[model samples]
Target: MMISRKLVYVASLSLGLSLLASTAMAKVEMNAMCFMKQSESTAHAFNPTKEEIADSSILKKNPTNVTDADVDAKFRIASLSKVITTDWAIAKLGPEYRFKTKIYVTPGTKAGNCNLHIEGDMDPYMGREMLTRIFTQLKPKLTAQSCKYIETFSYDQYFPVYLDAMKHQTNHDLGWEDPARYFNSTKTKNDLAAFLKVKSGLKGDFSNIGVVTKDRYQEYLKGVPSKVYSVKSRPLFMIAKDMNKYSYNYPPNVLFEKLGGAEAYKKFAADRLKLDGEDVEMYNGSGYPAMIDGKKMYNLVSCSALVHIMQDLDKTLEAYKGTRKFQMADVMAVGGPGESYSTFKGLYAGGTYDNTMVAKTGSADKAITFGGMLSTADGDMYFAVLTSPETYGGADTTKARVIIRELVQTLAERQKLKKFEYKQIGDMNATDDQSTLVEEPKQTPAGSLK
Candidate 1:
């Protein structure tokens, strides 16, 4: 009896060890790809039949058997979310739109003493250079006409400062700093006052910055300003161009919030691109991760949906009427030695791939993705590569990037697409005219500027 029991225990231990080994081997990583050749008008599926295989056919690979579901499976796309945000802005706001900041002066009891009211549109590109221009313009007007020192300053609720949200009026904190380190609005009130004093170079203590009730601000908006001046930001397309080239997180988030958040974005995606809700879960515009239900979630987008977005964006930019022509390279990072500051310059800079690709690269703790158009012999090939090392037999980011580079190189060679060339029309980092001052209409009728 004792010998039989010992044999049974040994068998059970062996089975348990076998199961553990199997589970360990199953923890491999995964990769998915979707390629759409413009000429074929079809997205290639992964590892398709030889006859069905083409540059446009949607293709993908994984540890398990590849299926159509994998093509539509949502993957956290990291900074690629900026592409979607740019698309929305181009469609809704147009390429020429510029953000505005309006200023109103209400003279105080003493001459040349005014209580200042600034209405901001949450300009995402507000930086030292832009701020310097605004203050430079303000100095002459404020010192000559209204007030040498702003007796008290108040701005709209949307001002990107740390104190405004802490007053318990907003739903959440607005102290989060953007990736550009431009405004640094997360600091305390004193920091703002000191910063403003230096930026303006005026002889006034600006520590008395105040906030008015929402009702009062609205009333002021409806009433014509007795004394007013305004500053406008660079056009929307230029802003979008810089945002993507640098992959700055703040600009897209501001634009996203201005466009009505995730729910609105979902509706837009569904209606415009026919993207299914399951494949388009965007919590924020920047593609930054969020915490929900005690779990961290990044912006999830399927490979097909992302390709479709790139296709649509290209078309939209092509058709847009503007002073100067716009192309995908204008709004996306170009892969070449020409654009020294672009995020993808280093990766695709060799002579063979140089300037032939305009792409966006996204990375997260678990996800490394690349998506955009590849100029090909057949036509422009829109593609998305989503990779993660968390799945079964997964590889780290470095290995995944190497694999992708080789894959892209192979595809280019197979299709005879390496001959395509993209000559940048102007310097990507060229600055627009900053001195052009757009004065708001002296009399803005009731609710017109709102």
Candidate 2:
């Protein structure tokens, strides 16, 4: 009996040390060498496109939850919202709805000496470079039209939504962090001008918003004078292209308005998806400008829903080639013989690099998300991940992104990670078979963001 007990103790101790040593080895390889091994993590996501062949290997575990779809916050996803906005806009307005900065001249307007009431619909065009290009292309037209001189100019964001105080009540408002002013598209009208009055200042429906206050926009625009020069945005598809490629913000905000109706955000996604769910719902279309009461926190869903949305729209998982709106590829940035910032190669900036990736990444407050199709050597696979902290992490962005990157790569080359017995690991999704392996688990955690 004593000898049997001793043998059992020795086996348990050996297994425990082996697990610790494996995790340590994985971490050390990353710092000491150019390679990184899986941390013996057994987490995985169900690849709907592939069959899971039952097999057993040296089952390892990831230090972090890489294959878990834990997104559940309704915070500002920043640029990530741009793609969804773009997707909806293209579907609604078609490719003809060019988001251009139209230089409308009320029959007679000039360059220097005329009533240049600069106008914008709060559209996602009117960028500095776009303005320069438009001017360059229309220079001959302007010259032929006999443009005259003007001493001063006044600009106005025609759409009053640009004047909104962000339903959110964070102090980030006073700063230039508002998506309206932060991105290239959807810049404030008269943004080029150093001095101009904000035409759309007050909300029309200041009181109860359940109806009663119709024609709100016309009421708001009633103050603008008759003579107005306008600029149309680039094609909606073009703007959408930029939004998706670079993850712009204000562009997506404007999109929710264009696709879901002007004031529809008051109803949130219910007005868009028009479907009820087992999870919480949201009122803001872009999910950014949520009210402060935390009422929108329940808005959540599974990766499968997102996949269906894309499929229904025919946003297929195909590579983007040719002269794309944006282009990105990796190049070796040398520090010392291979001591670079992220040797994974290339600037993480968005673009149609080789036209092989169609994805979106999201981050706001304490939440981070990434969803899309990666055209890997093995083939294409759709992945979505969400991380919601109890509170937003103000400064530790690196930690969040690192986690996102780990999740992305883990799903990208799942074969690299060994498999283990499935256990009740999280709060999102679980099934009857506790020992069955899963590729991706849907769970929510109250982890500290910092």
Q: What are the lDDT scores of the predictions, listed in order?
A: 0.63, 0.35
Residue by residue across 283-371, what tens digits does model 2's lDDT show?
33344544447443322444443433333223321232323321111101111112212112222221211233345655565445555
lDDT of 1: 0.63
TM-score of each model, in listed order: 0.78, 0.48
The reply for model 2, stretches above 4 Å from the true place, is: 1-79, 101-114, 117-121, 131-176, 180-192, 195-232, 260-274, 277-302, 313-356, 375-380, 389-403, 414-450
lDDT of 1 by residue, 320-409 (tens): 887877778778877655664554553332323455678877767677777878776567788887777563123345444544444454
